[model samples]
Target: MRVLAFLDGTLADPDAAHIRVDDLGLMRGDGVFETILVTDGRPRELGPHLDRLARSAKMLDLPEPDRAAWERAVRAVLDNWSGGAELALKLVLTRGIDGDPEQRPTGFALGMEIGAAVLRGRAEGVAAITLDRGIDPGLAERAPWLLLGAKSLSYGINMAAIREAVRRGADDVVFTASDGSVLEGPTSTVILLRGRTILTPPEHIGILPGTTQAGVFRGAEKAGFATKVEPLRVDDLLTGDGLFLASSVRKLTRVRSLDGTALPAATEAHAELSAAYEAEYA
Candidate 1:
């Protein structure tokens, strides 16, 4: 536990703050959350992230979050933070106090952390491992009632997978289905490129619809490249000309190797597109 919590309309450390035993969020992970990059005191893509979080909360049958209150809470945290050229802000809204899993609480908890950003800017890119995890085909396209697209706190499995990848000498892990089709990274979106055309798995395939991915497509199109979304296979990736992982924090990281085999790093065209998107956001 770290000292990063905004509880009950005040700034307090999580370890020092007291929560009710009936808090369903703590008991059953009954909550929705969003992590945004707060640069120069402004949270990027705040609107879309909050919209997704609200959708996720509704899917879980949790009480609707107070949008204005949540926004104010984040602003309060930012206002108190002293320094950090760049910071990460996390907004979590869970059913605050409830014993029965069948009942929703009237309030939610908001937490945030101010820390150094994970830097990933080098021509020598990161290595990755692909995990063959199975995702239900139905949940791939339409958001499921249970598998809400909102960010949940139950991320033990994802953290374990990342640890496994790091133990294997990879900086990150790319998740694949049992059928060998590509999905996404543990926290980023996957993209494959051939020549100048940019390709990524459709979000309908149970992949997280990434904000950075959309920015990449827009930048690529502006730079005169054909951007498309399609189902990608392992062979397609191995044979593809280049590979990249897109995210708000990481920006764009080239996948230099995959499953012990080398992948063509993002070429000049890819770098140009990435820089364009970064410039737009910066």
Candidate 2:
């Protein structure tokens, strides 16, 4: 696959890379970024994705990205990509190298086009184990200086949780607070179905406020499902009709099991919700 990297103001092949290590993002993981799926050479929800990226950057105290420049770079990468179907574009803006490690560094934008391999397409929806620390409701309302819902480069803990789930023979991990209130997945958003209502955790619960998940809910409401963002518990899944993990790439994958227990088969509501979500991006 041919890949292009836009570093600072120059766009070139990654192998011709001259990325500097002094950049905090290169050495210390100090930056914010966004990944988007591209279909038929057009980005899905381009405006919304850029909005989220800007919000995350502001939360991190980083300079806002140039939205127009980013879009042009994305289009350029796609133009060079021979395989245009179901591709992915990543917009990564990092704090550039500082003259001194103790000083704050200016930021630079990087764009890359890569192929996506979606395991969820062929595999059954994932089952997950709950985390002990449920996300605090208060944190979602007020941004903490460091954890203000920013898509920071520091995601070691999140990745570790997902690895733990894989070790237990599950596809992913679902985090909940000690109180048993569901939070979200390692890299995807959680959505549950109960009868006619579609449930997602409120953003005020410190959830990532997933882009794809929100899109799915919007499509669901249009398709006649009563969608809501509310607190959900692990017990809800054990007793609910079905559950799903939503993401830009994964789109929607039904959860067939939870904590080793098999979820009830998909109902009419689940089918309708899934169809609505899939059809929107299809």
Candidate 3:
């Protein structure tokens, strides 16, 4: 793994304790981030990831990210990476150290080979538990301060939820709104398949727009699968023809079970959709 920090347009070692203790992102979790997949030395869906990062920064009132600087840092780390496996490239932007007169933002890029656990989950499928997110689906529209759509650095709750799920003997979690509408996974997007139609929860429901899901839908359309956005419920997964959690690094992973109930097998669809997604980067 290698990390390169972009400080005022210059790149430096991330692990050398370069960030100040007063950095808002480190102190108050005031920041935004994106995780991109690098395959064969090329970042997949770089445009969408950067677009989302900009949107998140705007939502958080942080300075506009320097896309070119981030790109250079990504290239620097990837060029020096010697691993033959796929890599995960993370881009981070944080509000500058608190009380600083200049009020700048800290930005950096980190590159690491994809973990074996993530790869195994994608191959073996995953069992998930439904966790209540404790918010209504429409809350984001009414309360913008919640920052639901922004991929902010404040992920402590999300991480805790996943940890709790694992403690309960599940591999992951599918978060549902208070009204029982499926929102998304803690770190991935939820997608359902009924016949040849591919369905996902509407983005307006305070869920992060999934870059991998967008790519999957595009490829699905070409592969004769109708794509749709709809409100989904737990019953949808228990009875649907197939279910998956999609993301940039994890790619397309099937949901083998939900709440300990075995889901219908859709391995062929999963394989097709997974290949379709990979084709976008190819």
Pick the lDDT winner: 3
Residue pairs with backbone overlap in model 1: 140-206
What are the root-mean-square deviations of the candidates from the true structure over C-alphas? 3.3, 2.9, 1.3
Could you give the candidate ranking by TM-score, starting with the highest? 3, 2, 1
Question: Ten residues in a row with the worst lDDT in model 1?
Answer: 108-117
TM-score of each: 0.85, 0.88, 0.96
Q: Weakest 10 consecutive residues, lDDT, candidate 2?
A: 108-117
lDDT of model 2, residue 70: 71
Worst 10 residues of 3 by lDDT: 2-11
Best by TM-score: 3
Residue-level lDDT of model 3, residues 1-282, one tens digit each, is 665646334556656888889899999999999999988888888989999999999999888887787777777777776776688998989988899888888888878778887999988999999999999999999999999989999999899999999899999999999999999998999999999999999989999999999999999998889999999999998999999999998998999999999998798898888888777767
How would the candidate models be sorted by lDDT, starting from the highest?
3, 2, 1
lDDT of candidate 3 at residue 114, scale 0 to 100: 85
TM-score (C-alpha, index-matched) for candidate 2: 0.88
CA lDDT, candidate 1, residue 14: 55
Q: Evaluate model 2: give its lDDT.
A: 0.72
Residue 110 Cα positional deviation in candidate 2, in Å, after optimal superposition: 7.5
lDDT of 2 at 1: 55
Clash pairs, candidate 3, are: none
lDDT of 2 by residue, 28-139 (tens): 7778777787777667777888888888878777777777777776766766667646666677767777566554444333334442335543245567777665456676
